[model samples]
Target chain A: MRVALCGNPNVGKTTLFNRLTRSSAPVGNWHGVTVDVIEKRITGTDVILADLPGCYSLTARSKEERITRDGVLFGGYDVVLFVAEVNNLRRNLYLLTQVLEARKKAVLIVNMLDEARGKVDLELLSTRLKIPVVGTSERAKNPKESVLEAISKANAPSLPYLNEVAADAVARRAAEKNISPEFAALKLEERDAFIADILQSESSQRGCYGCRGCDRDRPSALRYSYIDKTLDGVVSCRRRYALTDKIDKIVLGKAALPIFFLIMTAVFFVTFETAKPLSSLLGRLVSLAAEPVKNADMPEWLCGFLGDGVIGGAGAVLAFLPQVTLLFMLTMLLQDSGYMSRVAFVSDGFFKKFGLSGRAAFSLILGLGCSATAVLSTRGIAQKTARCRTAVVTPFVPCSARLGVFTAITAYFGLPAITVAALYALGFVAALGALKIMRLFRASEGEDALLMEMPPYRVPSLKRTFKAVFANVCSFAVRVGSVVLGVGAAMWLLSNFSVRYGFTGGSGSSIMSTFAGALAPIFKPLGFGDWRAVTALISGVAAKETLISVISSLGGAGEVFGSAIAAASFLIFSCLYVPCVATIAALAKETGWRYAAVSAAAHTVTAYAASLIFYQSARLAQIDMKLFVVIWSSVVFAAVAAAVAHKIYRVKKRKGGAHDSAARKERK
Target chain B: MNLSDYSLKRGVIVSVGCDDDTHRRLVDMGLIGADFYIKSRRGGAALIDYGDFSAVTRNALAREITVRER
Candidate 1:
C-alpha cells in the first residue's frame, strides 16, 4: 500500500513523517524543504510512504504547490495523510478541503498535540469534518505508537465536506457561465489562469444558461459564507490564548534576540576554538598511519603518491569536519526554534533594497554552510530571474569550506582573528551589492511577493538535529575527499612530470604553473600577482577549498600568510572569485550552462576588480594606520558607490524606456 | 481614504479598497473582518492580532488593506 503525507507548510508534516518512517529528512522551520517528493518504504508493511511538498493550497502558484498538486492528482498513492497543526485547524483545513475535493482517500494527522495541551476538541473536529483525526507530536514519548495506529487504521474512506451553499453556488455558476463548477469557483476566488482555463473549457462544453442572479456571480462571498458556517459549527478557541503570539513572545521576544546572538556566538567560539586541537589530532593520526608505510621499502613513486597525494589531500578536508559539524548543528537548532525565519523576516527589508526576495535571504543564510548546497536550495524560489540572480550571488556568502581556507591563511599571516571576520563581512557586502545591481539591470518579471509563515517555536529534537549535522558532514566529506583527492593526485603528477625540461619538482614546474604564469601578468594590477596566487585562483575553480590545499602543498600555510595585507587581499580574492565547480554545475542544472558561464564570468571580473582596488589602496596606505580604519573606509566607499550606482541606473533606464515608448507612439 | 492616510499601527482593524490584490488575499484569509486586530509590525511585515491565531503579512499587502485604528 502507498501512503502520502500532505499538509500546509510548517504543519509538522515532516516531523510526523520522520517519526512514522524513522527517517532523517531535514525538518525545516518554514516551508519548502521537501520541495521534491521523497518516498520511503515502511519496514513491516508493503506500504510505501511518499512525503509530498508542504503547500498552503492546491492552487499551484509556486513550484512546491505544483509538485503537491501533481503528486496528489496523478501519483497514485493509496492513502493520503493530511497533517495539520492542532492550534491552526481552520487554516490547515483550507488545504484539507481541496484534497477532499480531489476525491482521494485521506487520514487527518493533527500534529503538535503537545502544543494543544488537551484544549483542542479533536472529537468534535472529527465529527464535524466526518473524518478520523489522530493527534500526535514529535515530542511525544510514544509518538511511534500513535503513528502506527493511524497507519493501521488508514484504510478508512475519505469524507469530503463542502458547505451546501458553496456547493450549490459552484453548480449554479458552472451552469450559468457554461463553465465547470471547479473552474467557476476558482475564477470567482480570483485564482491563476491555469485554473481559469480548466474551468473555461469545461464551461464552454456545457452550454451556458441565463440566471437572474446566480450564486456563482459572487464566489468569494459564497466561499466566505460557507467557511463561516462550517467554522461556526466545528471550530472553537479560547479568546485569550493566541498560539503563535504566545509562542513568539516566549521564543523571540526582545530578550530572545540577545539570547540567540549569545548562543550563536558561543557556537562560533566553540567551533573555531575546538577545531585546532581536533585538526592537529587528526593530522597526527594520518601521519602516524602513514609512518609504517613510509618506513617500508616500497617503490619511491608509490610512497610519494600515497603519502602526499592521497593522505595529504584527504587530511586537509577531514581536518575541518569538527567545525563543519558544529556549525551545522547550531544552524539546525536555530532553524528548529524558528528563529531563522524571524531573522529572514527582519532582514527582508534590508535585502529588498537590493531587489532580492525574502526567500533569497534564507538561501544566503544557508550559503554560510556551503555555497553548492545553498545554490541548490534556491529551487525554493519560483521566479526564474530571482533564482538565477541568487545563484550568481550565492558564492559570495562564504561557505564553511572557505572558512577552513581562511583560517589556514590567517594563521600563516599572523593576522588577527577580527581580520577574518572583516573579510567575511566584505564578501557579504559585495554579494549584496552585486545582487542589487543585477536586479536593477535584469528587472525581475511578474509580481513575485514573499509570503512566509512564522512557525510557533519548539525545542529542536536532538535526533533530527544530529541527523542533519551528520548528513551535512557526510556530504562535505564525500565531496572534499573525492574532488580534492583527484586534484591533489593530478597536481602531484603535473608537478613531478617533465616534457622538455627537468622536473620542476613542484607546482612551479607544472603545466598549471605555465598557465598561472601566463595569467599572473593579467592579475599583477590586482597585486599578489605571483604564479602561486594565480595557481590558487585556478585550483579554486575545482573547489574553493582546494585553493588552501594548493597553498599548503606549495609552501605550507605559513608562507601564504607572510604579510597581513597580502593575506587580506588573498582572502578577498578567494571569496569573490569564480564559484567552485560544484556551484557552477548547480547553476548549470538550475538555469542552463549559458547562465552558469555568464555567472562565472561576472563573478571573476567582479572579484578581480575588487581585489585590484583593495591591493592598490593597501599599497597607498602602507599598512601603517589602523587596519580597522582602512578596512572601514574601503567598505563604506564600496557600499555607497554600489548602492547609488544601482539605484540611479535602474531609475534612468526605466525613464528612458518610458520616454522612448511614448515618442514611438507619438510618431505612429 | 487612501491606505497611506490611515495611521493603522499594525494591530488595528482596517477597511480595504476593492482594486488591491493584496487586500483581496487578506480578505480571503479572514484578516479583513471587523473584529480582527493588528498584532505587531517588524521590518514592514505585520501580524494580524487574531485572538487565537495571528497571521503575518507583508507591509505592502497591509497598505492595500485599509484599517480603522481601534
Candidate 2:
C-alpha cells in the first residue's frame, strides 16, 4: 500500500516520514525545507511512503503548495498520514480539515505533544474528528508501528462544516461528477476554478444550474469555527515558548547581525585554529604512508606514480577532513537550533536591496559547506527567477572544499585568519555583485515578497549533529578516494610523460605542461601564468580540493606562484571560477544546461577580470604609489564610462520597444 | 494605524489592506483576524506574535496591514 505524509509547514512531517520509511529526507526546524515529493519504501514492508512538501492550505498559493495539493489529491495514495503538532493545533487543523474533506482514508498524527504546556485529550479529538489520532512525543520514537497500525484502520474524516456550508453545491457536483460529496464539498469550499467551471458548464448544459453566488470566505470561516468548537475542551496549552522569546531578544534584536558575525568568527576560529594540529598530523601520516611504497624498491616510475600521484594527492585532501568536519558540525548546529532562520530574518533587509529574498540566504550559507547541495537547496525558493539567480551565484560563496587551498596559500603569506576572512568576504561580495548584475537584465520580472515564520529555538541534539557531521565527512572522503584520486593519477601521468619521450620525470616537456601552456597566456595578466598553476586550475574543475592536491604534487604553491601577489591572485581566481563538475551537474539539474553554461562562462570571465585588476594594482603599488594611483584612476574612469554607456543604450532600446508596441496597437 | 506605523507592542488586526497575492498569503498563514503582539522590528520588518506562532513580515507587507493598538 502507498501511504503519503502531508501537513502544514515545519510540523515534523518530514521527521515522521524519515522514521516511518527509514530514510533521511532533510528535516529542518524551519519552513519549506522539503519542496518536492520524495518516495521511499518502508523497511520490512510493502508500503511506500511519499513525503510531500508542507503547505498552509490545499488551495495552493506557492509552487511547493501546489506540489503538495496535487500529490495528495491525485497521487493515488492508499492512505494519507496527516501530521500536526499540538502547539497550534487550531491552525494546523485548518489544513487537516481540507485533507479530510477530500475523502481520503487518513490517520492524524499529533506530534510534539511532549513539548506542550498542557495535556491533550487524544480520545476526544479522535471521537470528534471521526478518525484515528495518535499523539507522539518530541522524538517520535517507535511511531512507525503505531502509525502503520493506525493506517490499517484509518477511515475518512467527516467534518460537519463541509455539509453545512455547501450542501447543495456538494450534492449537485457530486451527482454530476460521480465523486464523493466530501470531495465535491472541498472543491466548492476552496472555490477551485477548474472544478467550479466544469460544474457550472455541465449544469448549464441541462435546464438547471450550479450553486449561485458562492462565498469563498464563508466556507473557510465555517471550517475554522468547527475546528474551534471541536478543540474547545480537547486541547489546553500555552502557545509561546518563553525561552525562545528571551533568546530572540538578543539574537533577533537590534544587534542581531553583529552578533551573528561574531558567532561565525568564533566558529571559524574553532574550525581553523583548534583543528590545526589534527589536520597536520593527518597530513604527516598520509605522507608517511607513502614512505613504504618508496622503500619497497619497486620501479622508480611505479613508486613515484603510486606514492606521489595517488596517495600524495588524495591524502592532501583527506588531511583537511578535520577542519571540514568541524565547520559542518558547527553549521549543522546553528541550523538545528533554528538560529539560521533568524539569520535569514535579519538578512532579508539586506537581501531585498539585491533583488533576492531572505530564503536565498539559506542556499548561500549552505554554499559555504558545498555548492552542489546548496544549489539543490534552491528548491525552497518559490519564485523561479529568484531561484535561478540564487543558484547561479551560490558557487561564488566558497565551499568547504576550497578551505585547503585558502589555508595553504594564506599560511604562506603569514596571516591565515585575516586573508582567509578577506577571501570569504570577497566571495560573498562577488555573489551579491553577480546577483545585482543579473537584475539589470531581468529587472522586469516581478519578485515575490517574503513571509516566513520564525521557528522556536531548540538545543541541537549532540548525537544527531555528530551523525550528520560523520555522514558529510564520509561523503567528502569518498570524493577524495574516487574523483580526487582519479584526477590526481591522471595529472601525474600527463605531467610526468611525453609523446616524444615515453617518460621524462620532473621534466618541462611533459604532456600536461604542453596542454596547460596554451592557457598560460590568458592568465598571465593575473600574474599566475605558470603551467603548474594552470594545471592545478584545470584539475580544480574536477573538484575544488583537487587544486590543493595537484599543487602539492607539483611542488606546492610556493613553487607555482613564487610571490604573495601572485598567490593572492590565484586564490581570487580559484574562489570565483566555475564550481566543481558535480556542482555544475547539480546546477544543470536545477536550472537547465543553457543557464548553467551561461553561468559558467560568466563566472570565468568575471574571475579573470577581477584577478587581473587585483594583480596589476598590487604590482603597481609595490613599484610606485604615484603610478599606481594614476593607472587605477584611468581604469576606474573607463569602467564608469562603459557602465554609463550601457545604461543609456538599454534605456533607448526599452523606449524603442515600447514605441513599436504602441504603433502596433494603433495599427490594430 | 498601519502595522508599520503602530508604535505600541500589542495590537489587534483591523484589516489587511494588501494586494490580492499578499492578502491571500496572510490569510493562509492564519494571521488575519487575530490579536498580534509585536516582538521586534528591524529595517521596517516586524516580527509579530499571532495565533500561537511568530512571523517575520517584510516592511512593505507591514505597511499594508491595518491594526488597532491594544
Candidate 3:
C-alpha cells in the first residue's frame, strides 16, 4: 500500500514523515525545504509512504508547487495524509478541504499539537470535518500506529461543501463531460492547466474557471469560512509561548544583524574551543599508533610511505571530525530554532542590493559545512539565474576542509589563534564580494521574489538535532576516509617517486617537483614561488585531502613560504582560490560546465591578483627588497595582465554597443 | 494604504494591489485580507505577521499589497 503525506509549506509534514519512516529528512523552520517528493517504505509493513512537496491550495504556479499538484492528482495512493499545522488551521484547512473534495481516502493529521498551546478538541474536529483526524507530536514515539489506523478508517466527505459558483460549475461541467461531479468540480477548483487546455476550445479568452465566473477568491473565502466555523467550536488559542516572542523581538529586530554576527562568532569560538583539545588528542594517538608501523621491518621506503603518507594524511582528516561534527550541530540548531529564517529574512535587504536573495545566506551558512552540499541545497530557490549565481559563488565561503587547512597551517606556524579567526571572517567578505561582482551584468532574468514565512521561534529538539549531527558525521567520515584518503595517497606517490616509480633521493628529485618548478615563476610575485609551495597549490585543488600531506612532506608551511608576509599571502591565496573538484562537479550540475569553468577561472585569476596586491603592498611598505628582481617581475606581470583585461573589456563593449544599435534599428 | 506606507503600524489587509505571480504566492502564504502585526522594518524590507505566521517581505513586493489601518 502506498500512503502519501501532503500539506502547506513548513507545516510539519516532513517532521511527521521523519517520525513515521524513522528517516532523517532535512527539517528547517522555513518554506519550500522539501522541493522534491521523497518516498520511504514504512518498516514492518508493505506500505510505501511518499512525502510530497508542500503547496498552498493546489494552485500550482512554481515547479515545487507543480510537483505537489501532480503527485496528488496522478500518483496513485491507497491513503492520502494531509498534514496540518495545528496552530495554523485556518490556512491548513484550505488544503484539507481541497483534498477531501477530490474524494480520495484522506485523513487530516493535526501535527505539532504538543507545541500548539491552544486547546484543541480532536474528536470535535474529526466530527465537524467528518474525516479521520489524528494529532501528532514531533517527538512522538508511536506516531505511525494512529496515522496508519486513521488511514484504515478514513471518513472523508464525498464532496466538499463548495461555494455557489463551484457548485453550479460542477453540475454543468459534470453533465457535459460525463464525469463525476466531485472530480469535475475538484479539477475546476484546482484551475488545473490540463483541464483548461482540454476545455479551452469551448471556453473564450478567460480560463475555464474564470469563464465560468468562479473567481479564486470566492472558494478560498468559503474555505476560510468553513475553518472559522469549525474552529470556533473546537479550538481556542491562548498565548502559548511568550518567551518565543520576546526572543524574536531582539533576534529578528533592528539590532539583529550585528548581533547575528556576534552570535556566529560565538558559535565558532565554542565549536573550536571544545573540539580543539579532543582533535589534538586524536592526532597524538594516531601518531603513537603510526610509530609502531614505522618500526615494522618492511622496505624502508614502504615504511615511510605507510607511516607518513597513509597514516599522517588519514590522521589530519580524522582530527577535523570534531570540528565538522560541531559545525553541523550548531547550524542545525540555528535552522531548527527558527533563527536562521529570521536571519535570512532580515538579510533579504542586503543580499537583494547585491542582486541575490536573502535565501543566499542559507546556502552560505551551509557552505561552512560543505561547499558541494551547499551548492546542491539551492535547488529550492525559484529563480534560475539567481540560483545558478548563488551556487557558482558558494565555494568562496570556505568549507570544513579548508578550515582544516587553515588550522593546520596556523598551528604549524604557531601563529596566534586570531589569525585563523581572521581567515573565517575573510571567507564571508570574499563570498559576498564575489557574489556582488559576478551576479551583476547578467541580463535580467525574472528573479524569485523573497516570499518566506518567518516561522514562530521554538526550542530545537535535541534528539532530532543529535540525529542530524550523527548523520552528517557519518557522511563526512565516509567522504574523508574514501575520497580524501585516495587523493592523499596519490599525492604522496607522485611527490615521492621519479617518472619510473623509483624512490627519489628526496622530494627535490621527484616528478611532482618538475611540474611544480614550471608553475613556480607564475606565483613569484605573490611570494610563495618555491617548488614545495607550488605542489601544495596544485594538490589543494582537491583541498585538505592533499594539502596537509604534501605540505608535511615538503618540510612544512614555514620552510615553504620562508616569511610571515609570504605565508600570509599564500594562505590568503589558498583561502580564496578555486574550490575542490567535487565542488566544481556540483557547480557544473547546478549551472552548466561553461559557467562553472568561468567561475573557477575567475576565482583563480582574481585570487592571484589579490594576493599580488597584498604581498607587494606589504613588501613595499616594509622596504624589504631582498628579492628585488623577483618582486619587480610580479609587478610587471600584474600590469600586463591588467592591460590585457582592459583591452578585452573595451572590445566587448564596442561589439555590444553595435549589436544594441542594430537591434534598435530593426525594431524601428 | 500599502505595507511600505504603514512601516511601524499594524493594519488589516484591504486588498492586494497586484495580480500577477506575486498575487497567488502572497495568498498561499495567508498574507491577503487578514489582520497583520508589524514587527520590524529595515533595509527596504518589513517583517510582518498575520495572526498565525510571520513573514519578511521586500518593500518592493510589499508595495503590491495594500492594507487598512487596524
Per-candidate TM-score against the hidden true structure? 0.82, 0.89, 0.86
Positional deviation of residue A406's Cα in model 3 after best superposition, in angstroms = 0.9
Which residue runs of candidate 3 sit more than 4 Å off their true CA positions? Answer: A154-156, A162-214, A443-450, A499-501, A505-511, A514-517, A530-546, A553-555, A559-562, A625-668
List candidate 2 segments past 4 Å from native. A138-140, A165-214, A412-415, A444-447, A630-668, B17-21
Global lDDT of each candidate: 0.67, 0.82, 0.75
Model 3 C-alpha lDDT per residue in residues A40-89, reported as the tens digit of each score: 98877778999998887666765677778778766777778999988888
Quote the positional error of residue A31 for candidate 3 in Å.
Answer: 3.2
| Model 2: lDDT to the true structure | 0.82
Cα displacement (Å) at residue A342, model 1: 1.3
Number of clashes found in candidate 3: 0
How large is the C-alpha RMSD of every model relative to the true structure?
6.0, 5.2, 6.0
> Which docking band does candidate 3 fall into?
acceptable
lDDT string, candidate 1, A482-596, tens digits:
7777776676566555566645556466676776778888877766777767776777788776776666555555564456676777788888888888888988987789988
Q: Is candidate 2 or candidate 3 better by lDDT?
A: 2
Better of 1 and 3 by lDDT: 3
Candidate 2 residue-pair clash tally: 0
Per-residue error (Å), model 1, residue A204: 12
